[model samples]
Target: MKRSDESTYSWLHRLNPDPYSLAVNAALLELVPPGLRLLHYTRTTVPAEHLGAFAFYHRKIGPFHLDGIPEPMQREMMFVIWRIIELGGRVPCAPMGLLMRELAETTQRLKTAGLPFQSLTDRTPAQWKAELSRTWVKRTHAFPNPQTFRTYVSPLDRACKILWFTYDTSPWWQREVWDLTMDPRIPRRTQEPSGQKAIHWHTMEPAWLRHGGMYFVKSMMESSQLAWSTAHGAKNALVQFARFAMARGLTSPRLVQDDRQLRGLMMEFLTELRSTPNYGIRNRDKPRSPASIGQITSTVRAFYAFMHDYGDEAAAALDDDRWDGLSPEYLRFWRPGDIGSSKKEHFDESYLYSDADLAKIKAAAPLLGLPRAEGGFGDPQAMRILLLMMTTGRRINEICMLDARPLTLLEDNLAKLRYQQTKIHDAPDTIFVDQEVIELIQEQQAWLHAHLATIGADADPPYLFVSRHNNLRGQNPYLTHVFRTQLTKLVDRAHLTDAAGDPLDLGKTHRFRHTKATSLFNAGVPLHVVQRYMGHTTPEMTMHYAQTLDSTAKTEFLKYKKITSTATESAVDAEDLYDLMLLDTRTDRVLPNGWCTLPPAKTCEKGNACLTCDLFATDERFLDIHKSELVSLDSLIDQRQEIHRERTGEPMSENHVWLTLRRREQQALSTIVKNLETGGSKPAAALPAPATQAREQAGMLGGQGVRTGHRP
Candidate 1:
């Protein structure tokens, strides 16, 4: 063989003179790029090279023996090395030779023993597990440390998956099953290794329907109309519809173009959805919940609507003209009333943690980060994230995706925290946090810095709460599943129980949001303010989180007596008023400054004239407002009188419509102030009659003809 200094592989000719070794070396060199061949074959110590393209450093290779290894094992080791180099992966070289030798020897032995194992990629997960057990049992010395074996096998598993799934070259939408992890559009912060990330489109029948479904889902994701999880759900719902359609031989969209046929088909699908068990492995035998049925129907309806609205685009994108078969009937295939309401009449308050329960949980919070040997789950990040959720009422993803410098300091130990509102688009993301929260954040930052330092990372990580392991430069945030697991352990350790004495379920971290919102609402925080704090786009969403406590409602209602427009206390008892108005369940009766005493069945004759109406009532809580209104009324009357004097030689007549109305309003306000100031204990006879009543009596007697009675 000839040697050339220009080629990095020239030194490979010096390793072994055999043709097989040279051929294997040449193939390995071809697999690796010239830029990555930074060292020669004779060099045992690998030099550190910073690969700017990959944004990572190729660290020094560990010591390993290459002599006396079989040629096939040698080729496998070289392939592993070149593969890691090609993919820009970081796998230490020392274990590469040993692991490759073990695998090669195992394969030969398995083949000789007629086990029929060709390669790792060909083995099922169960078969692979059995092979690993057999390998460990046969050669315990080769893998003394289980962790070392895991470390060596991890990269090989990834390589096999990439080969088997074609994850590198194939587009996710082109495959029958789309893995969210392979989709670049998905936000990395929300990605997880576990859970239902794979969306199976192969289950949908008929090639056209399947293709159209894929196009619809991809378009929805691309347009940001739905999240990845929501789109996955939509796909699942479409699969159900497809199954029904296929079974009935209605495979083509054109077959259901008629309104009556489509309606009938949808009705049948709804019936099947209601009767059939859930599609997944977990709840395969259980009947679908009403909420699930509603969601399925709604999603299917949305899919058809999308098809109808974007038929031309779908036809162009899918390269098929059949998409034009969708007619106007597809847009209205399911009526609004066809989908039953999924909302329950009674809310389950068990999800909320009361003050007592919170105290118990807080007392047990210290057990979260403790080591397993110390009788606690070793997860400090979970504890910190939990505390943040408890204080800020942020969504779990928001808390998990917090930036390294999320806090902005204001004056006087107050700070504002910014979080990523992952669920809602264009929602407010900042909330004022107190010193306690600030301190917790600072502590977390310090811990993260120290952790990064220990891992030889020089810069700050992108996220505040980072994953514990396999996080290159702490790029990935802590997984929500880990937090949930830690919380479950904490609940078990604390022996916490719900009101019903069952084991408390802290699995739903969102309950923290509900608990905080309810606490604020019951503490008299305004709904709009809570809405902003909770990062909700609407008050209705915030209200869903706030469950008003009965005690708080009754206490707030009975805080003061309800006085009538005549400055006399109402004849109805406070408790009776509470029941008659149903203040606990109704919000329409609540006024800005007081409560309206009008019965629900009766309509108000005086619209904005509440001050002069007999049905109006107020308490000391609105005393300041009444006084301010009185001052404004007096100023208005003086201004009008001055204008009248300017226009006429004499002051305006006392019976003038405007003057009479102002005086009546003044009398009502003054009477209310006096009643509120005197503790509202005076009898009705103690206060004089309102000016409106006197004017009404005068009008009835043909004096000035001023009409002061309620409108008929």
Candidate 2:
């Protein structure tokens, strides 16, 4: 082959003539640009500096000593070098370096054993390692260290598997293995916890059923009907169904064509799922939980529903007519009662970290990123990510995927942080953060800049917490599992425990979000405000995280005593009233400045007239609020009177219906404020006569007299 003039290997007028060298040159010509190859080199020597300039250079591997090695070994080395270059196209740089080193070592070992180099297809990793070890001992009269030998062989084995395996990029519906990571339509957030990315339809028993399932999953993805995580879960549940189908000899979709048989099959599957040992690694020997079984049954039902709805399209996609057997009745394979309810009777607060535990976690958080030599976890980025989570209450992925410059200072000098709302599409992506959070983020930015500089990476990184290894451009964010692993180490090192005194499961990094939400809500933050701050699409989602703190609840409830419109304390016992009204659980009874005093069973006849109503009550806790409202009301009344008088060309009537109601409300507020100012006293002048009190009670109860019993 003619070499280009700019090619680094152009100086080689005559090649080694060996097939390996010729093959290496040919492969390099295609794989690498001509300008990148060694242009000036002597036959006897290949310089290390020249090799260092190549894209596939291994930092640890030095110059080739061609004169010292035999011809055969040199040819073998060249062949392996070409293979390394090919593998590097698929793997990242850091891992590629290790793989190259291992392959180079293996080449040397093979040269020593006087054995021809063989591909993984001809010899398995174990077989090659065993042969190498036996040959080394026979020739040297000693054994190689077991650990060192395993290390030498491990990377080669991994590299071989990667090189030999071809990733399927065909139309998703046509492939048995759906590699979600390669699918651009799928968001990275939905492919979480790292490492597990592919959905293996081939693992499901019965080929025909597998194709039908694949069609369902593909349609779901194409239409954005399900997230990658949810789709993966559905795939898992279908695998369970496939297993049951195989066991019952229902190998084809046609086997259960009848709706009755399908229903029976589902019932049998549910029974088997309830009784069978879990196939999952975590709880392998235990029976699945009701929630787990329910999820499986629901997924299977959904799969059937999809098949029934898209029977024609699925049949065409799979090129199989069997999918036509699916009927609308198959959609109702399981009834609502058959599905187990997974709702908890009470919310579990065990996930929320206590103030004391939080302080402990904060104190020990630095150890997460400390060097291993310093008895730390040696993952500083994880420590920063943890601190960000603690302060900003961001989801782990949001923090991980933060831009290098995420903070923008507002007019008030406070900073607003911008993060990707990965879970909720098009949700609010920016949140107001305090100075502490701003400083933490800035510190992280500075650390990342310095780290990239040290590693000779891209100066302007895309992510705040860039992946530490295998990412030369600083393009990808740190993996969520990496941060969790470091956090788990910190928990163990600090002896962190949950409320139950069990070792804390920092694996649920989301507990930080729950802790922050509950703290803010308990500190009197409004539900709508908290929802916006947490980037929740609905107040319901915010409430899920904001469990009421018992201490806060008690403190707030006992902060005031209920006083009536006459400024006298209510006759009902406070504790009895609290229970009778179900104030703790009833949201409607809650008001801005106070709570409604109406009996739980009664309906108020007058609306927005709480101030003059006998059943309306408040206390000193709302003194300032009432004062503000009274001033505003007085101003409003004055403005309205002026407007009416100007329009009618005379003073507005004091007996005007609106004026009368306003004056009554003003009198009631004035009495309440004066009483509260005097520490819950009844003003002698404000106290009403027995007939007036009876009339007020009659008006409040819609003409019904006060009952002769304990007030609710």
Give the alpha carbon lDDT tens digit for every residue of 1-712 in model 2.
1112112111111111112333442343354334323322222233332232234343443222223333433333343334433222222233334334444555567767787763332344455567657756766688977775654444445433322222222464565545443344443453242333566665577877788877787777667666666778878888888888888888667556556677777778888998898988778879888777888887777787887777787888788877775766777877788757865443455557877779888998888878999998888888888888999888998898788888899856498899977677667889998888887887888898888776555688667887765455455678887888877777788899865688888888888988898888756688898998899888877767554454334434555688887787887666655555446445455544555677767777766677777776666656666776677677778888898989999987899998898788788878988888878544332312212333233233211211111222
In Å, residue 38's CA in model 1 sits off its true spot by: 7.9
* Model 1 misplaced stretches (Cα beyond 4 Å): 1-99, 102-156, 163-170, 183-196, 203-206, 255-259, 280-284, 546-576, 579-712
List candidate 2 stretches off by more than 4 Å.
Answer: 1-149, 165-201, 255-257, 283-287, 369-378, 497-503, 546-576, 579-712
TM-score of each: 0.64, 0.64
* Candidate 1 per-residue lDDT over residues 250-278, each given as its tens digit: 75766565566877777778888888889
Model 2 accuracy (lDDT, Cα): 0.63
lDDT of each: 0.65, 0.63
- Candidate 1 lDDT trough over 10 residues, lowest sum: 1-10
